[model samples]
Target: MSASHYHICSRNIGKPVEIRTRDGRVHRGIIHRVDNRMVYLRPLPQRNYGGYGYGWGWWCGFGWGVALGAIVGLALLPWFFW
Candidate 1:
């Protein structure tokens, strides 16, 4: 499929899609909820990551908190330290 054809929009809700988190884990599920900047998902049983917490399993993926924080820090270094 073409990249333009895959663009996500309002119609994506209720459709099945796969999500690849920061750590490379994949979650396939229906698009249960969507807002301007976020998606709330309810994964299918077969695609589950096997241990649930924060609505995700151990194999689901890692959070973006650390990565994004480090990126922000690096971006500020040139301005504040240099």
Candidate 2:
């Protein structure tokens, strides 16, 4: 994904979204936060066999982590050069 995609998604914070990764994995959840490169998602609660609701909590994928690191490095490029 590109930076613009991240920016656009960030604007939709708290809204439901379906993210399709490059590996063809799909994740459905409510967007929590979006930075220069990574989107945080909070999974929706699911009902178990016991009739109790369980939350999957939050998750950040490996691809997103790499992207975020790259973005942070680029953002600090100017500081390092100067």
What are the Cα lDDT values of the candidates? Answer: 0.39, 0.51
- For residues 26-82, write the lDDT of model 1, one tens digit per residue: 544555565444454555434346675455233254222112111111110121221
Candidate 2 lDDT over residue span 1-82, tens digit each? 3766666566777666555555555665566677775767666444355654555333444222223322221120121221
Clashes of each: 0, 0
- Residue 41 lDDT, candidate 1, scale 0-100: 53
Clashing pairs in 2: none
Score candidate 1 by lDDT.
0.39
How high is the lDDT of residue 73 in model 1?
12
Backbone clash total, candidate 2: 0
- Name the runs in model 2 displaced over 4 angstroms: 47-82
